[model samples]
Target: MSERVVRPVGRGFLFLDSHPAGCAAVVRRMAAEVEPRTPERRTALVVGSSSGYGLAATIAGLARYGVDGIGVSFEKAATARRTATAGWYRTAETAALATELGRSWTFVNADAYADTTKDDVLDLIAGKLGKIDHLIYSVAAPRRVDPRNGETYQSALKAIGAPHTTKSLAFDDGVPVLQEVGIDVATDDEIAQTVKVMGGEDWARWITALQDRDLLEPGFSTVALTYIGSELTGPLYRQGSIGAAKADLEQTALNLAKDGVTAMTSVNGAAVTQASSAIPGIGLYVSLLHKVTALQTPVEQSIALWDQLTGETPLDLDDEGRIRLDRWELTDDVQSAVRAQWESATQDNIAEVADAAWFLAEVRRLYGFDVPGVDYTAETEVDVEWPTTA
Candidate 1:
């Protein structure tokens, strides 16, 4: 093996390399915060369990619920001259943590949208876990290849009815710049394609496949992570192409209910994530939200979600039967403050009005940079082993 200093590499909001040590450190920190609550040996299947909320859910399952199962994600392995994706290291670290906890988990590095991947995961579950108590669907990808039709569908981030313009925070040579971003209205094909890639079709198929193979335990339940931003971001998010996809996801939850599956949509709070950074106006909104509200980290939110799902008290649901974890983020005080800042925020006063620095730092942390106590200048191992695989 070789050792070298792996600094953060990329331009603007796009990153080219991920530090293996940093990713492992972040996963360890998230695992440390979660106190194991139950010794119950439950089995779970976490799709897209490599980064962001999916990674958080997997850690919570292992640390809080003593869950032993499979995590599926698509990640690139490290080459001689190139680093692997951040998810690769994150999943490897998660497997290490699970081992320390005396839990067994397998990592399947493959496209979660493919039928062959699903069949392989089902076989793994049957051989290793026997049954699944929970299935967490937290996939957020730009494009997906339809397993049945073999056609590719790419999700778009654009408004639906009319062109929407808003103030956004852009990065100039790693500095935060206030700018106006206009998102044109999406075409009909774009909307449909977004829904196809980001919608709940794959989620439903996973559930059906598990049921068909008798892999679902008696009280089997599933949750798909989603977001319904406040009206400030409605035009580009809650009312945009992504919004249409989320609507389909929510409707899928209802349809699953009709089929007696205990499935629900989890409306997570806005946070700095690799997926959210791709949205047009989300960076500014999330920065402002962080400035005003004490937002929950993805791991914290996932822990709370697991608590809600397994707590002694009844599960709280909105009028539509979806869990509202964004309640803190959408509070009247928080939104009002963010709106006031939105009107007057400029590059000169961005640091005071919005936590742009925090936003940038969080984004850096997503790719294993800006994490505490990790010496970015020191020579580090670029190639790390994935702890477990199926």
Candidate 2:
């Protein structure tokens, strides 16, 4: 038996197999919130369903809400030389869990921005699962190629109005150290392209496609993920180019509501995801957030957010019809404390002030590494077959 030597590299790493226990932790943490809840026996179409909130919702929807689902994600398959993307292994693990739970699902590894991907997902749902009751859109990409003209649009993470400077963390040989990073105002083209790539255009297209094919059932609700941070990070997040894209997304939600589909944006908390790591100052902000916040797992956060929508609260939205899952992080006291820490966050005190160990572990756990009780020394295969549809 040949033992695989998979482990975490500097910022992120891929473990060959999904940690069964880790997946269970996600399901278990959110199970109680769903037992006495309404919205039973549903079907969902998750656009970015391989990982993060999409993956978490799929597992919880099946385990707790009695919902069958189809997951659409763009992930690379494993090779002899290297492991597959973490999302691939997560899909395999989800398949096994679905079987144990007597649930049904199909995972499509394709580009979410492509029309055929939506067609393939709809075909699977229309054939085996029937009409979808809920749609979760959480796709994140740096570039989007138009399905019509094939024109490529790239997104930027720069502040929208002026140059913004902040303290950040960079790994130095596996050590978390503080660094100063500056984000400049994006050019007009950068802002426009960012909106094209990260904005609501692709989301609107998906909804239109589903409606045309009659894949959406009555009372169907769709949620697209967004983030707006405190004043400390607003220049780079809420007021940035991505913020412009999110504004477009919110407008799309209004248009979608007029189409008779309950569409809204879910503003999630600041947590480390595959998408956030590439942002300039998010790593440090996340690390510091732990100081004032309990720091729920991403899976836990997603399940809890979904629970709020189905719970007695009626998906409490601000005047904008956006679900505010960052309520815990946005409380006046929490914001004040975080702002205080952000101003005082210097390399001399980061180690003492922030929980670097927890942040790093969370990042590794996303890739199936650093999981408790997972035997990393065991012999594991490099490639595994993906689950196919009915």
Candidate 3:
């Protein structure tokens, strides 16, 4: 094994390197929070199950319900001179722990948006697990190549109708700064491309593929994770190109339901994630939210989601037949407090009015830095392998 010190090597939420030990620590930490319930031999398929809410859902299934799972993700492996992605190490550690716990697990490193990957996963499930109890779709990608047409479509983060100007936060030489940012409206092609890439068409395709293979269990359920932030971010998020795509995703669930599939969208709360950090004004909003409220981590929300999906209690859905895990984050009182702080926040008083430090730390933790028990100075292994078992 090769040993070397791996430090984070990116700026402003774009991490280039990941520490294997630190990623393993995060996986173990999430697993420890869950109390194992009665053993059940259920099977789950988590699309995009390497990071963020996807990873959380995978861990919850393994730790809480003792379910065997196949996690599908597209991540790079480590080389002789470079470390693998954080998701790589996380998946590796999860496989190891799942084996120790006697729960069968497999990590498929392939393009989730491809038809062949679906075929491969179906074959694996047919050979290993008989049926799928749950399917979690939590993909957050910037671009997607349509397998049918071979055209590449990229998702845009631009506004919908008109140019949107807002106050945003950025880091300047490791210090937080307040800046006025503006995003121009998306063109017609841009909106269509964004919808094509981020919308629910691919999700529907996955469900159809599983059905064709007779892999869905009786009473099998599926959910796609979504986010609808408060009006503070309405112009750029709720009314933006991404928002249009999310609308398509939500509608897909309804369509799937009409066709006799148990599918629904789960609106999750906002937190610091690599995808969220890239959005305009989200960093500032999340920082303010952190200062005012105790936001639930992704793992915490995933555990709650699992409870609602498996427990005796009925799920509390909104008028649109969707799970609302973002209730606490979008509360009237919480939004009022955040707005009050937003009105008075400035570069000079931002540190006092918002939790910039906490935001930075969370970003660091995304790539295995700033973890509580990890030693950054110690010699660490950069090359790690995914556990393989048939």
Candidate 4:
């Protein structure tokens, strides 16, 4: 059994106020970047909108911009025996809370890689919200079925040419056990498949489909989130199969720009998320990285990035036209300190060099656990309804 809490909330009540309270702080800062919106004419669409940056963007859109949005995510609901995915609860809570505050939102649960999902989303946007003014692509999946051919492509997380060995941690008998793990290199075919699954294909498809239907509003903007870590984890991330996908995504952004919408990739610092936890060697790397950098949470970073993208600055972009939000994580001093810790890290010393307890708490928070003010002992409503529109 996996040691991590995949389902943190059982039949217990989840404190609803803390999440929006946390989001509101980020929104107050984000308000500085948001131009006053003339409501009733704006709509936003977010793919993979149930969690992480997507969820944050959704909340910011509602709370900061007061924009109506249609969100698409594939998350399973709770059952009698099995707990629901955290995203499900988060989405429900977000919708319920936003509605109480006079916001309009809709969540479509569907696979983003499917043409059918895109079609359904376009219909929702056309019917409920009119046209989309902003689109956010934040889907992180290991496998994708090509909508054109129905062939499945799976992504891999590995070095390109050689195996990278590192000291890692895993839960054994409910105790943290340190061990040495070697991740092998990816073959050429594997690399290609990984790129195919994880790259910008689906994003382009959604944009083009919207364009064909004349659903994208004039001056629309879209962004996809990516990550590029330090050299220590390059083999597993920045120079690996997923990196290839991100490079292709960057190219796709350039192409999309030609079609008149602002499209770009925002590189973010590593954080503990459901998708990220599955990446090999990332747990140890992120723990040490956090200790050295003291990086902000994803929601904080998302608000900052949104400010840059939507503020009067006209979307600051690098030479490659991509947003660089990982500056803090890649600073010379932070990387140097992290490198030093990496060199000294061992099974016995990892706990000392890295804030292991903080890392665990952060991971738990992702699944709606360990939040400081949330009363876990309270009785929760397992059948919370999606918030209704105004």
* TM-score for each of the candidates: 0.98, 0.92, 0.98, 0.87
Task: Give the local distance difference test score of model 3.
Answer: 0.90
Clash-forming residue pairs, model 2:
none
Report the Cα lDDT for residue 191, model 4.
92
| lDDT per residue (tens digit) for residues 67-135 in model 2 | 678888888876665667777777777776677666778889999999888888788888988898889
Clashing pairs in 1: none
lDDT of 4 at 341: 86
lDDT, residue 185, candidate 4: 89
Q: Count clashing residue pairs in model 4.
A: 3
Q: lDDT of model 4 at residue 144?
A: 94
Q: lDDT by residue for model 1 over 1-390, one digit each (tens)? A: 868888887888878889888999999999988978867868899999998899999998789988888999999988876898999999989998888888989999999999999999999999999999899999999999998889999999999999999888888876789988899999999999999999999999999999899999888889999999879899999899999999999999998875456999999998888999988778999999888889888888898888887763467799999988888888888899999998889889987898999999999999999999999989888788877642
Which regions of candidate 4 deviate over 4 angstroms? 1-41, 173-176, 386-390
Please write out the lDDT profile of model 4 over residues 198-246, one tens digit for every residue: 8888899999999999998878988988887878878778788888898
Stretches of candidate 1 exceeding 4 Å from the true structure:
none
User: Candidate 3 or 4, higher TM-score?
Assistant: 3
